[model samples]
Target: MRSRHVSVWIDAPPDVVYAFAADPHELSRWAAGLAEGSLRPSADGWVADSPMGQVTVQFSPPNTFGVLDHVVRLPSGEEVDNPMRVVAAAPGAAQSEVVFTVRQRPGISDEDFDADIAAVTADLQTLRGILEGQ
Candidate 1:
């Protein structure tokens, strides 16, 4: 698997950033593509009404360590683990860093990986915008 990560700095505190990200209800607000695709809750977890059909999203429980890992279950039953975390810039700084890590599957091409990176970057930017009140 090929791993990649994208991050954005938020002016808010780590706890605040983590709280906003841990809520599934806020996914649509920052994840514009998924929202536009009609992502909604299913029996087990949230489902994204993607072009390839329904994709289920399952997230890790909220934790104090800022772990916000999640898995996306595709129509083909492939589970993609998306690792995310929020870290403070310093002990008492108001700034925080939100990082998202994605591992590309073996069969994915370079172009598709690039697109995925772009999408993740855009999503993080949107989150920053909402949190920073820009």
Candidate 2:
């Protein structure tokens, strides 16, 4: 149940970042570790071919609080909760700080956990690049 928070700073407003990140259609653009180009709408949620296998992603309802929390159901039927958020870097700032929590599953090794963190970091960086038009 151990977890780590991976975050990135984007030169965009929080609302903009949240809007983009919360959209399932835009997941493949940055969240390659989870969706790549295989994400599509499903009756239950969005399904994607992830590194682990096929996964069903269910996102939280849209809101103004910048919460982008989601649940990913693995092919094995295990649901992984992913907590994410976009917030203003400073009070009334135009910049945003995107954070993703990476949790270590019961049987994961240290190396694997670190790799997961690295993957999340890379995804966040890609999101930043896209939003900042780099």
Candidate 3:
């Protein structure tokens, strides 16, 4: 799969950024096109009441390594893997970086890939703003 990676550095601790971004509900705030409405725990994982119907987001097991990966289940049962990571600038550092990996398949054109890159860049900017503004 072809993929693009975008990242933003925020003036906050990695733990804080990881805690907020790891939650599916919180993603709606920064990732505008991700989903909508409230998120609640469901049998499969965390479900969000979105305009596209109920979307499920299942995250990786909890860890202190800042690995905030997750999978999104569409209403049609298609799953999209969103690989994300929050890295501390250094040991005991207050600065951190959040990276998002956007993937595309064989049929994705250059224009679409560019658009996806821009969207991810915007989302990362929003994340930086939110974390830094706090």
Candidate 4:
């Protein structure tokens, strides 16, 4: 198993940042490389399907803070679950921090985890731009 965590500071309150980040419509704003995605009601949480594959929202704290779990199905019928979490900085500050954590499944190699982290980091930069009014 492998994991990566990255965080960035945003010049906004926690709630404002959290709300924007949680919106499905806003996902495309940050996830630029994504092919497509749409909202789907699921017992898991808020789910969506994108070019990267199927992602399921796991725990969403009220006020838009939470974690989302994703799984991609390979052509060979194999599946890997990637755990992702978003943690916000305390409220009332001029800037807030958005943290992303990713952990790949057991059989997955470090190379795969590193690649995913790179992709996710790119999106995070996009996300920061959108929130910071760039």
Best by TM-score: 2
lDDT per prediction? Answer: 0.86, 0.92, 0.84, 0.63
Weakest 10 consecutive residues of candidate 1 by summed lDDT:
31-40
Q: Which stretches of candidate 3 lie above 4 Å from their native place?
A: 49-53
Residue 48 in candidate 2 has what lDDT? 94
Model 2 TM-score, all chains together: 0.96
Model 1 per-residue lDDT tens digits across residues 13-41: 99999999888888878976444554577
The parts of candidate 1 lying over 4 Å away from their true place are: 37-39
Q: What is the lDDT of candidate 1?
A: 0.86
Distance (Å) between predicted and true CA of 70, model 4? 7.5
The TM-score values for the models, in the order shown, are: 0.91, 0.96, 0.86, 0.69
lDDT tens digits, residues 1-134, model 2? 89999999999989899999998989999998898585788998999988888899999999999999999999999988999999898878999999999999988899999999999999999999999999
The runs of at least 3 residues in candidate 4 whose Cα sits more than 4 Å from the true structure, single-residue gaps closed, are 32-35, 42-47, 54-91
* Collision pairs in model 1: none
lDDT agreement of model 3 with the native: 0.84
Tens digits of per-residue lDDT for model 4 on 46-97?
4556565665443344444345444544434455554544554654465777
For model 3, give the 10-residue run with minimal summed lDDT: 30-39
Per-residue lDDT of candidate 3, residues 12-79 (tens digit): 99999999887766888877656666678899998886656888989999889999888989898889
RMSD of each: 1.7, 1.0, 2.0, 3.8
